[model samples]
Target: MTRTAPAPTRRPASTRGGPVRQGPGHRRAAWAAWGFLVPITAYLLAFYAYPMYRNLELSLRHYTVRSFVQGDAPFTGFANYLKVLTDATFVPALWHTVVFTVVSLAFQFTLGLGLALFFARHFPLSATLRALFLVPWLLPLIVSASTWAWMLNSDSGVINAALGAIGAGPVNWLTSPDWSLWSVTIANIWIGVPFNLVVLYSGLQAISPAVYEAAALDGATGWQRFRHVTLPLLRPVSAITLLLGLVYTLKVFDIIWIMTKGGPSGSSTTLSTWSYRLGFGNLVPAFGPGAAVGNILIAIALAFGLLYIRLQRRQDPS
Candidate 1:
């Protein structure tokens, strides 16, 4: 009886026209996705791409203040880039910017991490306190810089008053080339902390409670739990926040401009402020060099962005 039964034939994968059918639904879904993306694509092309193209064009053009008025411009090729790179002022500005970015990133990240940790715990009045703490970031950049400038004024400023009370002499914070950069950094830190805190706090919230519970059950203390569980989980967020902070700090202009305007001796000039000074503020208006400076900044930011993307890819290979 077993031998007599014929083997059942296998059916083909397809019914009519093909082995496997992929119909209009798949094609429609793909078209719909492209349709959804069209608006943002158009916006980027119109705004960012066009502006960047124009800036690159401007970078190669030789246009002085007089040239701007008379509509007479000529191609200068890489001369602008050469001038910017060779300038003595540009070298010091670059050094100051690098130093400021490193030091400010350290302070902002450390302080922000502490604040994030503090706020991670469910404490009374934490929300209100956080709201109050964000006042520095909420304030306009010019206003915040102005306020710091006023406070740091050598004569009769609050800082000087405090110094007098503490028996420390009034320090010429902005007037001295030595302290002017630090003064800008301090104000920048105040503005930057809130952003870091918010980012880190959100990261902290994403950590699952069950993991903490499991750690506690395994006889882990708070520090141990945080070190093994919390810190590991927060690494991605930390990297993103730190990189973003670095980029923003690198592009800092308003605070430096408002606080020091390149200072009593050009000590506080950053790339952004230096670019503005070279391009628009000077009587002759060095447009080529200014655009070159801008291009340099854009390169740096793009580098950081690329690094972040690479890191993210490494972290999530799937």
Candidate 2:
């Protein structure tokens, strides 16, 4: 009656010799992952990293077309960078670049957000309309630039014709030094709107219907709801969008080149066009200084990229 079953004794780790139970399949999978990564790592090192290193080397050297032909370029340390900084076109081109980027981003974000909000509400043919709006983004940049150039031409252009009809007396859309930078800025904004629309619309779609419903129930107006609910949720997307816009807009050469050739007295020149002007625009190319300008652009991009990463870490912290 009193014979109760005794509990089983635990095995000691020393006697058990634990964790020796992994199979060959697990080892194969681990090896396969590294094997898969090897090609990607090698490709990145060969293509991106190596070229960047070579560019840095070129920037440090007193290289020219003759030196390239001779396969010898003597190192001049930071002289090329100094030359780029002191060059006549550098300051003005840099100023135009800043103004162009800022104005373009301001208009693009404002208009794109408006379009995104408009499309967020359910309506007839909304999806089809949204898809149609992506035409600007899908077209080649060179094509868009060429098209805008023709449209903005002062003579025999639709814009000038329309202005003349309205008694505005044919304002110079492209050739005037006062308006050349803004002309390209307008075209850039048009080209960039679709990208912002699609991205911001996706972000808006991710927001919960219940959240908006609750906000509406709490006596929030349309603007109030957008400010309190939508904006807060969309901050991350907007941050990345603007940062990428900065990087992309900063390097916009084709639009400025095709539209104005940085012309009408260097009014629309950006750093990218300026770099090209340095390296290949004329008979004697300044390869070293051009490379230096490109490297400076890369540095600015990398700084913003690092800032993006820091923001991501703050958002995650995991």
Candidate 3:
């Protein structure tokens, strides 16, 4: 019994080496990932991060065309920002920016949600109609602005023509100071609706039909179901949609520039347009002030983005 079995020998824990074998495959895979990321990292740094830093630097200094050319801009604390804040056009431009953003977002979201809901119904040609609606969003902003420019032109424009046909006086849409801002705002809304529709429609599709069935069983009517079930579920998607829409609308430049150039006594001048005016509009461009205004716009967009991030985390703690 004592000699029945010999004790098994225990193996050594390890040798002096940290890793017995370092795999070539794993090292190659890591290098491959770095290789793929390198170009994107370079592009972002070159195009976005570098430019933003340069612009911010320019904002804090007394920069000019000559200074820019010679690389010698004198540091001037917050004077440039002060100049922008005190400028007469600054207040009006800020107001126009606010009005344009608010009005365009309101109508865009409303019409887009309406279209999304309508298309959510599986009717004949629903998919086709939705695809066709994407034409506005796919077109270049220049082309869209040009088309609307012709449509909104004072004389011989389609819009005024329609008004004349309806016995209403032809309104100067782009030229009149009273209407220029609204005209651009309307054009922007038209351009933005298709994007919002696509996003919201996709969100709607992601929702389960079983939820609606449950709501119906609970005696919730159409509007009640939408408000209680659909809207609550759609909150996350809606937040992202509105957040992006706000940021894009705030930075709108091409439509305003192409259509009005913020014309007719600067009535339609938005913050973006005002920045352009300050920087390159004058013979002696005010680079510092222009950069300052641009930085302000960026700050606003950043604030909204941070808010969105905060909301997202709150909704999804994980």
Clashing residue pairs found in predicted model 2: none
Model 3 TM: 0.88
Judging by lDDT, tell me the better candidate of 1 and 3.
Answer: 3
Go through the candidates in order and give each one's C-alpha lDDT.
Answer: 0.83, 0.83, 0.87
Stretches of candidate 3 exceeding 4 Å from the true structure: 1-32, 313-318
Q: Give candidate 3's whole-model lDDT.
A: 0.87
For residues 9-43, write the lDDT of model 2, one tens digit per residue: 11132354344337868777777878989999999
lDDT string for model 1 (1-318, tens) is: 000111111223335453232675877777887899999999999999998987887788888777767757798899889888998888899999999899888888889889989998889999999888888888889889999999999996799899999999989999999899999999888888887787788778878899999999999998999899999988977887777677677888889998999877788888898899988778777777888999999899779967766766665443
Model 3 lDDT tens row, 178-254:
99999999999998899789888988887899999999999999999989998998888788778777877888998
Off by over 4 Å in 1: 1-42, 69-72, 313-318
Q: What RMSD does model 3 have?
A: 13.7
| Candidate 2 global lDDT | 0.83
